[model samples]
Target: MVQQVQEVAQTGDNSGQDLVLSHVTKRFSDFVAVDDLSLTIPAGSFFALLGPSGCGKTTTLRMVAGLEQPSSGTISIGGRDVTSLPSHQREVNTVFQSYALFPHMSILDNVSFGLKRRRVRNPDAMAKEALEMVELGHLAARKPVQLSGGQQQRVALARALVNRPAVLLLDEPLGALDMKLRRQMQVELKAIQTDVGLTFIHVTHDQEEAMTMADTVAVMNKGRVEQMGDPRELYELPRTAFVANFLGKSNLMRGPITEDLGDAVAVDVSGVRVVLPKSRSAAHAGSAVVGVRPEKMRILDIDDAAYSPTANQLVGRVVDASFTGIITEYIVDVPGVGMVGTFSQNLGQRPAAPGERVRLLWEPEFSFGLPGDEEPAEGTDAV
Candidate 1:
């Protein structure tokens, strides 16, 4: 059966309301947290603000929830200007990592709190419906302390959704749960969002969480949006080294542009010539960095004879190999490319051992060029 959030019958359709931010910025004295940023979130979409610590993702979420005012920007929800509105007045709700449920209240009462505050008719029915949406209707009579972490999170979500807000802001709502439960909640949260038809703007530092749940992900850096698109697009065709490195692992090699093939470009990384298709090239005149995902490169015996001009091959010595049942991972030391990583599926073939000379081969199109050195920030990178 299809479940939906119990919006008031008179509220009508709200699928057309988009969240728009124009020239948004937030500064704290000498520090500028969120630089000039602009983005549009379509109505009823699952959007995510992803980044490392101090990247302004949380600050941006606060601005949207009316918890923090933007230094300079206009915020509108469903076509109404609410840049300066208070949190309670805006037609939005927030679910935090803490899952701040009242200890004294029963689950049913906790879920219905927002509705009762507004004096909605038949608050019990609406709260029960919201609980059902999260598959927690049976637990409504229990206290929050009696429920598990995942159960508590569902309650928090149910509370937020009971009022049928135009936008729902989630600030790392699953951060408190264990990794396994967190993954489980990610699926549940997405399903609830789909059933309810509400815009969900999520803020998370976990790359896997954002990639797993968000329909559109905006990667933020130093208070500015570095890139925004579908998760696969950002991962496969990262425009900046920060994005490429931050989103996931990438084998980046710095080199100079050796030739421009019109539809493709050749780069010399540590004396190794690499070809990349122009469609995905970020190659700049002089120097550039070529990025390829570890999974895209294959480890082959050095004796293989077949070679193609459109493919890149590097001779390297295996520095280390880790066999994790399903895949064999290798760290190879290429002469000009420094240390490179590759993953090969475990299909009965023996993995190369340390000290073995091997060949790393991949199609040219699997590589992407960036304009500069791969200088992703060190330490905890995302918020």
Candidate 2:
């Protein structure tokens, strides 16, 4: 089986090793690409560096792979300092977005090229075993042009894994595939990493890609990490406005804290009052920005009998509505507040059309608060 081949191929002394970057920084002629970033990637873990364009995610990955040296910092693998080591000396391999395989050579030869150069014994057998691990052994005799895009990508991955590096670096490896194929590759990549048990550090600008494949995600902004955690934690309880808006859609309202009720606090947005949990609030006093995801809000008729007296309510007129199969998306404009978005499930009940008055209601515990000074639009346009 393919799993057996992977298990045997990965039985090296440096199979699972921790990668550490201490005070890593990269500067290019006065522009700081990465500023004082530090991270600890555990052994045999899937970690992703996610951000928009020019956020220093790719630069950080280059530093780890020795393609670009950090201006000031140390990179260590398995507690050994490899900051000054060259690319060939370090036990690391990288798979780029472009499948840079040799067109003139067969798939087996392409994978065995590195081993052959190093004068390793039984290069053909080792390369064949690696190809089998990726379920491409049957196509070993075919050239790069003879395979599909997905198959070529698997070949590139097999080439990287054939070396049995201590760590694997993926630089937007699935960026070139089509949407449906990209989703398929995401699942395959995660399964391969799990079977091999190697430390994988992936860099990507796609939020969904990072969330779907990585066990932990670090969101970067302006050469610094805005937030880092598991996908669910970062989505449910964002610590900053950028994270709240970047990870997904959020309805943010700025207000002043009026009262602190031990476990919760009350804030006044315009003339309306809303309650936020103390544990979920980053700003305790002064001003704060309360945020709730669109899916957490319910758009109901103004005089609906299902309205709960204890729920936080806001009155607004539906500015726009779109029926998207399973859910109806609505944009409501409140008099004192800006436009707020909400998603209501379509369960046969008629949805509020445009120009209709409706009430937006949500539980207090579902809302999170960030510092008032943070820009609510920091990451709204990132996608």
Candidate 3:
């Protein structure tokens, strides 16, 4: 499949076609859907625009696809201004969530429709190769109704790939699939992007989907980017409370900065002094919100010998514990802190039950600090 796609890729040079959006903003009278957004997507990379609904990710994608014009600023592809160009004129194709395959047309004809419209020679052959690239050539004779949801999605993808656009836009293309199939498609879509070497800008609200398939992820919130970077980096060191809470579960400890230790800053959390690495902190002098992921914390008995004296520790009573196969999730409530969550790997030992007093400990370096003024509930509701 990969070799076949590479052969088709030789038909055109799709490399080095960077998609650049400069200070783009889109407004509908009173509502600003996308605000002063500027992004440079490198060629041949899989990038994801991730956010909750109405965060302007879809608006940004529409502007890139020429479906919606930006109220202001320029949209360019490969140094050429394409801001005013219609969707058809731009070197881009979009695979929508609806699949949009012609119900009556055979899969091969459906895939070949765009090529035929553009007067490309041997459209059927090209489309067949595309089907094979997606490993759907054997189903060419079937109609859309005859194929399953996952197969129909592949047909839609092949239809878009047959056009051989420099940039491909995926707008929640896997939203219709079940959980297991969605995960399967994520891997396949990433592999297809690598095989074709086309710049793919995926817009999705699913955090796992964005993190799994994209080489770079831009987390947008309320028409602006909260953070953008490699998925691992963004997860490890979130710059804002929204990113910390939205990307995954984070326990935020808000307090004043008591001292700066050159390499780390000390914050008093409910009378417990916790240290955060200076490089990981977005706040320096004023009060800060310290954050750590649930998986980074361990629930230990107060007298556990494994407890390190230097580690950040918070004592709390277990409110609830839910065992989910590989890991047990616990909700612990402390006197000063409202509620803190922890995930302990199930290693054939009994989990700490409810009402039991436990200590949550994590390495100080694992902590990240954000501005104290940022709302702790900013991105919690969206999840």
Candidate 4:
């Protein structure tokens, strides 16, 4: 199946291409896999589509790759409409989770297969350069079965890259590797993409993988995009509770609006007041959900010590303490609300033991507000 890609002619256009999807959607029977999704991936930019399984991320990638046709809308590559084009005619290459290398062929032969079929001159020389790009030039004589998992994965990458397609689509390409090798490959993949200056559209369910490799990330939910931005922007100011919880660990507290100060609003969470800036939220005065990341919160020893009137503080009894190498995670039980988790670095103060009373301190600016009762689109919980 992989060798069939070699039969397609290599496009002469050498420039990188921007991918644009306008109101693209896919429907399977009565189920809509993707819904009115529009995105713009700039030329030479590394972008990631991230979500849990069955969130339409893979379906969206398939639409762009011409593997799956959209029920409605159009897809354009480099300002040329290619929605109706076949996969072989789209000038795009895909590297999937499976290496799919030819076990009977040598590494160099595997890399040159596509070029040879396209009638490119000096296929062996071009293939050697591609192998060198992946730091596997020395292993050209080895067969697929002779190489380790990482080396085989690199050979697969070399195969895809030898054609120099306008866009490179990666669908969880590191999912098959172990944790250590996967981390190593993530760095190498991003570095290679930078060196080649190609537009890379990667789809992955791992948040860390997307955050580490891509310059921009789009978090998908159900059939639509929930949030899209740089890793820092999305992590710091999640627009919705789902983004807050799914992207990373967050403590969500629901409360009624007590004070509206235009730029900021104070919410009363079970007799405790917390202020969040309005710019980080779309919710007005009423009920809202305030989110604070576990790392942003600090655990301070409190023994009948009154906190400052203006400070954001939550008094809780420590119920559990867990040491996770560089940091210690503490689960505290607040009075009205349930358990709230916080992480403290192991560099400084020792972790408080269970049953110890502590105060959670965090800046008001760290909190993000969102509508408490906002109903997400249909099937939003698929993640």
Candidate 5:
């Protein structure tokens, strides 16, 4: 049996949010794309719809943009339902991943294209203002092919923001840029959003992008929203196995509760035991999974590891170690915990090398129950 839902009352100030998706679904023949999804995005907030390909993330965003018509349910912008509205009629603008800029048109002309179509009184003046907003005023006359990938992206952003819509939707806008440029654009995008005070709903399958730029993250799976919360909450207190495994690195331990209370439970996990803070039920108390983040695992030298607690100690042989500049990652093969990934604090140099034996420890508070999925066995202590 799954745990009962915890009741939390809603408040009024929540209604003034910019985007609302209520039981919104998109279907193609019989295949359901967006499945009765409901969500509220506040104004001036940067929100991300994150999932793997074909997980309905893009479909949900498209429904918001009025690009892909929903088969059922309603979508609203700034509080009014616009389920039947056309893309152009909604107070929303989108920047596609392809840049979608006219190749021959100059940067200024491309930005002005949307305003011109809407028959704005002074399209040139508005285009100049938009170009200046993106710091592209100096490059206004340059063609799309003439600008670098990062510059081109800025122009694309300028085009979308120029309309001054109520909400801006981005569909993998950074997917085209190289790693360095992508990193730069992430900061720039967040800065621009904060400055403009506009609601941004971004769609991406990239984990780092979702965490870094967006104020809140909504992780999706299968055609439904698996979890929705701030990035810190989603990563630290993942409620489901899919969320734990998908969002970040996790060591999942399978077992069942030996004792239970209303608010907490003691679980027997692979011969080890841990007391989880939150109460959970899984069918019977016979089986469940505990997810622990890699960073939560503390690394200790063999001597320092001697006194580790019975509930959390794990001895493992390091299969591989790689330095990633800021932090070093290691693949540790542990006996009861399996092969779990971990990281060490960067102190200017890497501490452990490949083939080293190490021990990692944490506590019961670090563990949480996940309903399904179990990994294979691994580990042998070899220095």
Candidate 6:
């Protein structure tokens, strides 16, 4: 199923696709926000434009929403060229981070506003059904300010979805919530998208959010998509160091060319040597960077180090340790590469203390390498 979708997306020009952006580029006076960006989102898929701020995730989304015109390239939704269409003309709706609700209007009224403006039949009934879809029917009488952040976000979702647009654009819709609420709403939003079978084109700077919600994740940098695939496909087999480091925590190692082992590019990173899963198409034997996620790395006691022969062990002195309930974060000092962190599940055993000598170990496949330390991405890398 995944392969079919991917093949169709890669080959399908404009037929039967929900959205397609070909060679999309956007720029301000001296800054290029999205450069030659191209992507296709399938119908009923939850797609995330994941990156840090200024990476053009939002800018790309704006182009899709008809809010921003790409300096070049075509933008299509439902096989229609909507690049130059006004936002109102596009069959897409956006749920903004600010909720964009009418504070004075009740929840049902808020949801019905768009339907009323479009003169949809039985606007009140549509609003009620939309509120029910979000499980907020009971609160439909309340005003925007009267609802919690989660509730307000639900109302915003209902408003956008009541019209049943072909695509739903979510631009950090939960960014304003507290941590706990944010996590809860992530599940809620995903559930809503699934239930409605709506194609969601969400943009966010949060890696975890993207991982949790997206069917396919696109990692962006400096106006270009660095890498993209399913979250696990990206996490377990990152094609580049940037994708590895950005998705989660990593102990990045850099080194000069040593050997090109057909499937893998072997190199010494500051004296430590480890073979990461190779992307034969992308690896080169130059200055290479390896990124290993912290959870994939284990902190072994000196006596236990020998037992971890399969683990790529790094020697370090525990500079700091913090018990984070679920896991303990340990900052360890490596000789030339500087400090790296490893996370230990707190439930396993009490965390090792600071100043203790330890070894961090992980399977060779846990890490990945790419062209080392290129110039930092300015307005395009993250946003």
- Highest-lDDT candidate: 3
Worst ten-residue run, lDDT, model 2? 1-10
Model 3 reaches what TM-score against the true structure? 0.98
Q: Over the stretch 1-383, how does candidate 5's per-residue lDDT look in tens digits?
A: 00100000011122244788898888999899989999989987999999888889999988888889998898887768899999989878899889999998999999999889989778887777777777889999999999998999989988887777778899999998999999999998998887777788999999899999999999987789988998988888777767777787777777766776557676776666666666433323656677778887777666663564656667788888878877788888877667878888888643766677877778767766766454312111120
Question: TM-score for every candidate vs. truth?
Answer: 0.94, 0.96, 0.98, 0.92, 0.86, 0.88
Off by over 4 Å in 3: none
Q: What 10-residue stretch in candidate 4 is worst by lDDT?
A: 1-10
lDDT by residue (tens digit), candidate 2, 1-383: 55655643475766437999999999999999999999999988999999988999999999899999999989999998999999999989999999899999999999999999999888898889888888999999999999999999999998998888889999999999999999999999999998888888999989899999999999999889999999899999988888888898899899999998899999999888889899999998999999999999988998889987753789999999999999999999998888999999999998898999999999999999999897877788743
What clash pairs does model 5 have?
A: 1-283
| Alpha-carbon lDDT, every model | 0.87, 0.90, 0.92, 0.86, 0.78, 0.79
Global Cα lDDT for candidate 3:
0.92
Worst lDDT 10-window in candidate 3: 6-15
Which candidate model has the greater lDDT, 1 or 3?
Answer: 3
Where model 6 places Cα greater than 4 Å from the true spot, the runs are: 1-17, 257-266, 277-281, 284-287, 305-311, 347-350, 372-383
**lDDT assessment of candidate 6:** 0.79
Clashing pairs in 6: 52-382, 52-383, 53-382, 53-383, 54-382, 54-383, 55-382, 55-383, 222-380, 222-381
RMSD of each: 2.3, 1.6, 1.3, 4.3, 8.3, 5.5
Can you give the lDDT of residue 275 in candidate 4? 89
Candidate 1 Cα lDDT to native = 0.87
Which residue pairs show collisions in model 2?
none
